[model samples]
Target: MRFEVLILGSSSATPIYGRHPTAQLININEQLYLLDCGEGTQVQLIKYGIRSNRIKHIFISHLHGDHYLGLIGLISSMHLVGRKEELHIYGPPALQEIIDLHFLHSQTVLRYPLLFHPTQDQTGESILENEHILVSSFPLDHRIACTGFRFDEKKRMPTIDRTKTEAIGIPTAYLPLIKRGNDYTASDGTVYRWQELTLPPPIPRSYAYCSDTVMTERYLPFIQGVDLLYHEATFLHDMLNRAVETFHTTARQAGQIATKVQARKLLIGHYSARYKDLKPLLEESKSIFPNTDLALEGNWYNV
Candidate 1:
């Protein structure tokens, strides 16, 4: 199984010449999970060669225009393209109303089913789960009701030792129970321990996404020790005061959070438009957290 993230847009509220707003595509076990559908996200997806039909789940952090202005357009395009698969959207309370109003005014009935799952609380909890992975959302300190998401893969089952089984003349019927950690007792009273016949399961991988948040340590527990973390760094250290005033985070602040959480790697973005060059921001973040990298548009990070 592969887990990867593609940076679709990195610019902040103000649009830059070639950059769009905040959006990302997270692919886990072949399922596409979209985070923050910023303006021009569909176009970006097309540019990156990502098929829109693969996106089954979309997560919005807040109601900011820069974070979700492209949602209606994306859905409309999906409908026009004759998408018949059900789509699930997770966001704050008002998101359903906003999309409903848009569809109502346009009199466009979607060709596929749209399911809205609203985030109503602050504490971190699992929001979506399947056999292979689980997704959890936690509250973040922002100007509006915002949340961050954590994606964790499920622990894999232990691999069987085929050589041991063959040597012992074990029937293929008992392989299933043996792989599940169950000891198989032969007809002659020969006992085979599961631990002796199987190797340990692989460690699960995790990724966390935090967007448009202020400096807050409360999220450390939820995102701790993730393989990769994507956090917003909208300003440089010089604009710490402005970051506080606007409820955004400076590059250094984002690095500090990544350090506190002990993340393997950190990617920071949602840059303020005033910055024509992001070298300073990247340098500032790297000064605190050496593994930090700028969230460049069209770049892919494997988790």
Candidate 2:
């Protein structure tokens, strides 16, 4: 099962140098999910050779232009190319109105069905779930109503040790019970522990995306223990006042939040355009959380 995130764009406010905005393409169990379709995201998707049609779901963090400006373009492109599968979008309620207005004036009806799911801004709640993963949206401390998303892989079932079962001539009918943690009894009255007849499954993996949020503890519980965390670091600590006023986090503060949440690894992004050189931001974040890495465009981070 492949679980990774491809950074499409990470620059904040505007595109500077080689950085774009805040778009990420997440792949989990071979399904692709798009997060935050910033301006030029469609172009970045093409540049990265991503098959956009495979992405059935899109999650927008907020209504910020830097976060969702490219959505119309992407949808239009999908329509132009004749997409037939339904596309599901999860975002604030206002996002549905925005999308409707764009297409209304353009007189464009998509060939594919576009389903809009509104996300809550007051509390964390499961917005989407499948056999492999669960996605929850939680409120963030931003100037505007914003939310972060947490993707958690479902717990896997333990596998049967076929060699041991076959050696003991255990009936196939007992396999299900053994998988359910029941002890297996032999005809001679010997017992085999479920743990002894099975191999433990891999630990569930999780990833969290925090876009345009200030460093606050409000969303900490929702993102705790994520295998990979993508948190916005719009400025350096030297501009802490600016960061607080803008409701954005500094690089150093992002690191602190990652540590507090016990993130296994952190990818800091949403960089302020003022920074053409991201080395300082990476250094600042690493000071507090040594596992921090810069979320640069075109880079993929595996979970």
Candidate 3:
């Protein structure tokens, strides 16, 4: 279904080590869904050869400057480019206000429709769904009203067996019904079971993004068993105290969460500026969760 993630920026509060801030793109079935528009996100999008007009949805985990500072610029650029399609943004309620204030002061009105979906700070909710994927937002343990996002591929219909169906002289019109798990009755009254004529559906895959959060079990259940999990690792375990103080996570702690949640693979990022080299962070996460990888910018991770 072409479900994959492209890391745009992975820095923490400040851009360092040649990294920008936190931003990413989740491509599902050829459609692009943006998550967390940190500073220089549009530039990264351009550098990565993605069309800004192709992004229909933007998900912001919080209103933190490092997380959403690039939103206004991106929006303005989209407007300047003459985009006319509606743009949907999912985030905390105050995010809309922030966006509105910026546009209002600049005396600029977007040519495209701006739709804001507010995420509850206290509870999780289904924010978006389409024929291909279901997206949900869950509360995260952060200094602000933060939330993590989960994208689950929708269950696919059973595959129709063309050999069996054609052998039985079934019309093409009935093929869709077969895929939908419906039995077919031949003109002669022989009943063909749908189960016998179709292959089992493929297992759905999932990806979760935990933008900026401290180590806590509160969000574990929401993201459990994700095929690919993106978690913030703002520091190493050596700076565990600072991580806790700032409501951020350490690489070791991120690995622990990945293990506790039983994630198949973990992508750790949101690196603090103090780190010039991210290999140590990757090594620390790999210590506990051997399937962990660093969320390096410009890299696409398949789900």
What lDDT does each candidate get? 0.92, 0.94, 0.93
The model with the greatest TM-score is 3
Better of 1 and 3 by lDDT: 3
Over 1-303, each residue of candidate 3 has an lDDT whose tens digit, in order, gives 799999999999988778999999999999999999999999999999999999999999998999999999998999999999999999889988888888889999899999998888687788899999999999999998999999999999989888898899999999998898889999999999999999888899999999999888888999999999999999999999999999999999999999999999999999999988899999999999999999999999998
* Model 2's TM-score against the true structure: 0.95
- As a whole number from 0 to 100, the lDDT of residue 55 in candidate 3 is 98
- Provide TM-scores for the models: 0.96, 0.95, 0.98
Pairs of colliding residues, candidate 3: none
Alpha carbon lDDT at 170, candidate 2: 95
Tens digit per residue, CA lDDT, model 2, 1-303: 789999999899898898898899999988999999999999999999997898999999999999999999999998898899999999999999999999999999899999999998899999999989999999999999999999999998899999999999999999999998999989899989999999998999999999988888799999999999999999999999999999999999999999998999999999898888999999999999999999988988999
Clashes of 3: 0
Off by over 4 Å in 2: 170-177, 180-191
Residue pair clashes in candidate 1:
none
lDDT of 3 at 262: 91
